[model samples]
Target: MITTTMSASERFELSSYRIPGSDSCFYIPEFITEGEEAYLIRKVAPGFRPALGPSIYERLQIRDSPVQRWKQLANRRLQLWGGELTSNNVLVAQPMPSFVETYPDIINRLQQTGVFHGSPHGKPNHIIMSLVPSTDPSQTRADDSPGTKFVPCLLCVVDIFLTVEVCVCVRVRSMSQAKTVPPRSSSTPSMSNRQLQPHEDGPAYHPAVATISLNSHCVFHYYRYTLPESHGGRSIDPTPVLSLLLEPRSVVISTDSLYSNRLHSYVPPFQARLGMPDQRARRIHEIKEDRFTAGGAADFVSPIANWERVTDAATREVLANGGALTRGTRYSLTCRDVGKVAQLKSFVKR
Candidate 1:
């Protein structure tokens, strides 16, 4: 079954464009053709359904091709695929289902991205595609209370919690039902908007996150570290060091500094704009110019610091290109590895 799901032709073609100075991380623009993009959107539609209750809508969220639409949440909006992280930070073992894996070119190119080179599986074992609704007052609640209501919640109509274990690898068709409530915060609401904090991705899974931007274009914010002290009650600082212009159909792999050293989040702006020309801007929605980046060294791409410890030169070559690295409504396939499978089952059963 796994072999059948793995397509021979579906791999990243431009294997040369990788990020410089970084150990891991890769970027590929137009990783998927316009037609494939439409096909994926159509395939995910059926899986989108209410999870908890009727209040929330569960369905694949995407606008017409070239226009990215981000689904909103209190903190931010993101789609979850594969399976939820176990309480201990491990993902249950399972193959990335056919609907996702059928695109071999995209996956194969990513294999060379170097993000997954160190994992036990030697490639991304799971994938997730989701749309983050633009952040706004509607996304927030009345009292300004912080919790899942503030974050956003997906209603899981299905009570399917793979109790039997089986290294069950299932994709979250839509995050409409997943809990988006915010954890205890530290600092006062400093920024006009809230976002994902900059912190090392915990050992919950592997150390890489491969994101594909779709719909509109937006900048993903990254911070150096958590706040020195928890101000509002939360301890992390989700700020923007630099922003990645996530274009529709582009693929961005988050590993090394992009993944381990810093925190990443989407910045929701009232008016999104793209610095590039109208022809290029039209490829995505809410194109923004200078939303995050400044001038000089900032103009060129810089690899995440501390990433050298993780990957080799061959893998880094695939990330530097200018393909499908759009911003708005981006979906990420965070490939990771949990530990020994048989032992994991024993632990989960307990």
Candidate 2:
């Protein structure tokens, strides 16, 4: 198990993980132990079997008994440990699967770090386990659901055989770059760029999201949205403002403007270009290598956001040398505390 001796004061001193040039984003390497990561993979992998059936009963029979419930999507498979949210965006009151609720390393550490101290439930009550195939074109999109209000998300990524790359984009909100709206009441001040409107469906967007990576490393790119006279609307800036090298077992947290305004997506494996002038040729050349090695010359083609704070010397060396990472199947578990919860009927009798 992963152990830490840091006191509360030390744990809350998260300034080291903060990514510069953005409002409030943080990254930590190796948030979980190797053993814990392996166990999580085992627990979620069985649901990926092709034994899915058209009927619910038929699907349940694939495994005599399963701990979690599965929902297959067009390009990926999802296992929702807690009950699904209601039409009004409330999570039905239900216990999470034991495997999910009992993970003390991740749960406790997050609490100690004070990431979810202000959330409605004071902890994550919903877990969405996503199994993304290597060839899937659609990546996880930005979530603005009512369930995401006032909660910090903890996303854990586990890859099988080191073959997948996950990318995250953070949008930064600024006063000069944003359009403002007058407040409805005198007591309320004018809203700045990207601030949630009163009529907006969901609660205001939370600023923090924490992601832990396991089994493999990938690149994270950040972009700013731009409006052009030619297009008559806003579009993603072709070139990323910054890029970061996410080493295996690392964790990244984005807050404030980075979480509310930025758009994040994972770049497809073996794609030739990433639209940045300095990275275009480097990315193409790196993907061309027949066997993807975690460390090689192609990895350091761009400036990593928090290079000085990395604890692992080898990871630092790999990035300095520009290493390469191969693609593989990856599983991401995103935990959130839905703002609304209703005592609805239970799906499982337990």
Using TM-score, give the best candidate's number: 2
Write down the TM-score for model 1: 0.52
In terms of lDDT, the poorest run of 10 residues in model 1 is 161-170
For every model in order, what is the number of clashing pairs?
Answer: 70, 16
RMSD of 2: 17.9
Model 1: per-residue Cα lDDT over 1-350, one tens digit each: 00112123554333343544334545555555666665664544434322221123323333222222334554444444444456665665444445565553455556765557777777665555554533344432222345443222234333222221121112342246544445546555423244343445676556777776544444554556544664554343322344444445666666655677766655443323323211122322232432232211122232232222212233223233322222223344444554433333665688
lDDT of 2 by residue, 35-125 (tens): 7766665555533322221111112211221344456653445766556676667677666656555653455566566666787767666
Off by over 4 Å in 2: 1-10, 46-68, 134-205, 228-233, 272-302, 309-315, 346-350
lDDT of each: 0.43, 0.47
Q: What C-alpha lDDT, on a 0 to 100 scale, does residue 265 get in candidate 2?
A: 40
Instruction: Please give the lDDT score at residue 206 for candidate 2.
Output: 38
Query: In model 2, how many backbone clashes occur?
Result: 16
